[model samples]
Target: MNPILSNLRNITLTYAIWLMIGCLLAALLVLTNISLWANALLFAVPSTLVFGSISASAYYVARSLPMKKRSFFVVAGVFGGTALIYGIIWGILCFFWNKITLLFDESWAGIEMNQHLASLLLICGTLLYLLSILVYDVLLALDNIRQAERREAASEMLARDAELQVLRTQINPHFLFNSLNSISALTTIDAAGARDMTIELAQFFRQTLALSEQQKIALSDEIALCNHFLTIEKIRFGKKLQVQMRIDPDSENCLLPPMLLQPLLENAIKHGIRDLVDGGTIELSSKVRAPWLFVAIDNPVDTQPSSAQGTGTGLKNLQARLRSLYGDKSRVEWRIAEQVFRIEITLPLERS
Candidate 1:
């Protein structure tokens, strides 16, 4: 069934209620040669035709109308068309079946007709048709609004999923590349340490297998993963890399993206401190600032412009992760300042 038609039953009920009103009004003022029964039919017939015509025509307009500004011609066209069509239909019914007009009996069995009564019925039919169409348009507008809201929500969900996919892409390869590099570096150093690093690398892969199963972990867990990540880099770089961490007692309990910090730390080691003979400090801090939690990683600047990459794959991946994990509520900034490279992150205290 058409939604507009399904809605028509309610409109019919309204016409019935208003028909009663029309009957009462007729009883008070109009005293004609017709009986009470004929009088009621006259009013009811015109009311139904007018109401149905207006309601259906208005609903059609609403279904077809655009969300943008509407022209006056559209309103006039629907009202005028409904009035003309239902007026003719109701006029035919009233002119043929009217009992009072047929009451002439033998004088003119079916020859005589009440053109005056037909004209009145036509006028009332036209008026009611226009009125009801306007009412139906209002209902159609409401349905359009609801549909728009659903579409908007669907679009937002799609965009977020795309961002998450991008973040996932960044994370997997950034970690893998570093681990692969470590294995390559380890192949020449202590064979026992190389073997151990491979085992930890395997452990990291096992942890990643559950990524789809879990989107978030406690802040402490992210830190632990970073420690493991650093362990691998430590074996490869040996004593040429130094790690410093300062975690706020309060921030450790909050949930963070599952593998967020490890990538940034890995990036810092790979790009900033690895090539230098004298190692540089890499600092990670978690602190609370009123409504926000700030997790920042600062490392020594790679003052020597090293050209060994197509792009910063780690930065791109981190951007996707930030968008997926915290959306607009979180921010990450990477910059080289005062001979130090820093990646500062701000995430909401979302548990509240």
Candidate 2:
């Protein structure tokens, strides 16, 4: 569709510009003493309007030769040829239209056609057609830019989703392997404990599978999953493993990416508690402060640095996921000081 004709606003604006051009053409005739205002307007305005409507065909011509596909020489040749042809057609129409007006009073109805005036009108017509072609080319370029931006945005979204999926799969299997190994270790010494841990593990996995499919879940739901996870870990580690949560009621309904906090808990236990002869409590806390929701995990670690200390894969993956989902609006930081490994996250407060 011709852009000008596609909507009422463009069509109206195009004709309005052509009307101004028609008045300017008449003024040029009057200034040169070639025709009276009345005679010039009668000939020029309607002729200019009809030619303007015809010029809309230039959109198709410009679109046919896209900017990226055409050479400079090709554009110049095509545009020059089309403008000249349009100018010739316009001149013929003006000549016939003036002759029709001669059937009425010549003084009030028409401009006198002379060699000089005919040549001038032909040039004006050619210039107007060329201008139309240039305008359409600019519109086409803008449309292409918009389309390219949309495509790039969509591609980035797909890549982010794929990365998140891979990370989720990696994290789940890592924990599952560790859990099964713990169960296997218990089978010989205490079959009853192994059976209980296996049952708890099954329940935790069932809940995780349901929530993992969601893009976002309530903080309370995540906390509940973590509690279920802690139950399984307690059965395996016995009295050595403990958890203390101080979650603000206001922050519980806040939404976050699913499986975010639970993995941090797994890391805290595996890296921080496992090596200590007397395991320490994992402190889980959350609070809402205006625009931000803050959560932190603090656990005791062995004073001596050992190979059992984490390689930081889980923390790095958590940071990457936050960056992908929230950009600069979210932050994750971890530090080891005074034999305590603390990980904290800050996110924009979101509900439902």
What lDDT tens digits, residue by residue, belong to model 1 across residues 236-323? 7778899999999888877777787887887777777875568798999999876888999998865675787427777777776777
**Model 2's TM-score against the true structure:** 0.94
Q: Which candidate is the best by TM-score?
A: 2
Steric clashes per prediction: 1, 0
Extract clashing residue pairs from model 2.
Answer: none
**lDDT tens digits by residue: candidate 2, 64-115:** 8977789988999999889889998899989999999888975698778999
Residue 266 lDDT in candidate 2: 92
Clash-forming residue pairs, model 1:
54-133
List CA RMSD, all candidates.
6.3, 1.7
Residue 82's lDDT within candidate 1 is 59
